[model samples]
Target: MLTGQTLTTPQVVDVANEHEVGAFIGHHTLAEFHGVEPALLDDGPQLRDMLTGALAQSGATVCDIILKQFEPQGVTVLALLSESHASIHTYPERGSLFMDVFTCGTVAKPWLAVDLLAQAMGAADVRTNTVLRGDTHPCCQ
Candidate 1:
């Protein structure tokens, strides 16, 4: 259960199975944003800011961030989160970008981060995939 105060913090939960005893601690979200403004994808600073804001809004703690701009066009922003990590790689020519957010607990919402980023990038088309990690399930792993 999450209260307002605890919503921003990672909470450990027991996700043990009959065969194994451990915690299911990973939530990974991968997204592709299409039909965005090319300029937005080329701006490293703006992309970093967008990712930082999205992580914050999704209740993930940012440890550090690094942004790199490419020669012709494009940008990449990587955020190190207390929960796990998140990254964005842009393709300015295609007006698209790929985003990934993975958190190591149940509290932080990785999907929300993807949603926020997509909206901020003004993506006209968005596709997302979520994988629950730290489990023995073949599909999840």
Candidate 2:
């Protein structure tokens, strides 16, 4: 099983519900979209373009793009953005893609990448794992 980690401390939270203080009142949603088409998976330019567009469309600018490819065109692309990062690993043989999009202070945008992937893969369907990014509850008033 693949698990994830999220940091949360009391200093990070600030009464989420009411304006009762509103410290940790912000939310950041992280999502993983996987299971993409296999045939269209290629590394380098394709991956770079996708990663770049995904971040840019989400109101984040990419400062760096790292893409690696394996035999049979299995590509892993990591995009480092000003706000956060978005990554995609495509398995061409299985026609699957493992994607992670995360942001710190803003809500993550999923449809941009999803649309691009669907076009790139001609995917029949896509799946998503949306994590609410659990953090510490602010007890301080």
Candidate 3:
């Protein structure tokens, strides 16, 4: 043992060891955007198009999506994404919506998707909740 150094055992230390540190990516950002909307979500085709556009902006491709109108002022939408999935429930009379986006990959941009939904529904003064996902390598130790 010296002043600036220490003695070591005969074992070898591999400095070249490398590993994958994937971003805290899955479900990285989940936001709840709600506000007063001037439109209703009852048109299946229209809803599909809006969601499709949102996902498209974030470099994602949609395989399939489904939208259902519960009533005059209520609706439920289930959206499928190549990375994962997202959904929204609208209450027209209340002019509010409950939205969720869960996905994994570099293409996961929840903000873009939420913004598109807000624009499509004509929502103003929107609110949001962001949940960043995390993934760790158990073997990192």
Candidate 4:
């Protein structure tokens, strides 16, 4: 598992309040998974289940989801959540997986879902970037 710098709760609150009067849009985490098990990447059902479980663990309300498998190898899974959405794409040949989790509202933690997906995929290394999305102007309120 890869560890990266995380924003403290106060920092998050401060960012959220930076644009006074406007509601926080959401949090989005993009992850690059390296050295993941090939078998795990090719298993569409397993990947789907992992994403679903991760979303549930993150307190996201899953609205819809879809999984697609390519010929020979590779799988793609997408979950639509009440907060936002999460998706996973696997490249078994490259021993890599790419994932994104975006969640709206203060109650959901998209980073948790990213971590869970990395763990479930048996990643040896993970690189992640998180962005706070939404209107930043105070007038947007």
Q: Candidate 4 lDDT, tens digit per residue, 30-138?
A: 8888888898899999889888998899888899999999989999999989788899999999999889988776667888888777776667788887777665346
- Local accuracy by lDDT, each model: 0.79, 0.55, 0.58, 0.78
Model 2, residue 26: distance off in Å is: 7.7
Estimate candidate 2's RMSD in Å: 7.8
Scored by Cα lDDT, where does model 4 land? 0.78
- Give all TM-scores, in the order shown: 0.80, 0.63, 0.68, 0.82
Tens digit per residue, CA lDDT, model 2, 21-132: 3223233333333445445566457667866875676566678888887775678888886556777777676756667766544333444444455455455545444443
Q: Worst ten-residue run, lDDT, model 1? A: 1-10
* lDDT of model 2 at position 94: 72
Model 4 weakest lDDT span, ten residues long: 4-13
Query: How far in Å is the alpha carbon of 72 misplaced in model 3?
Result: 4.0
Q: Model 3 reaches what TM-score against the true structure?
A: 0.68
How good is model 2 by TM-score? 0.63
Number of clashes in every candidate structure?
0, 6, 2, 0
**In TM-score terms, which candidate is top?**
4
**Model 4 clash tally, residue pairs:** 0
Question: After superposition, which runs of candidate 4 have C-alpha atoms over 4 Å from their true positions?
Answer: 1-11, 14-24, 135-141
**Candidate 1 residue-wise lDDT, 63-101, digit = tens:** 999999999999989999988899999999999888899
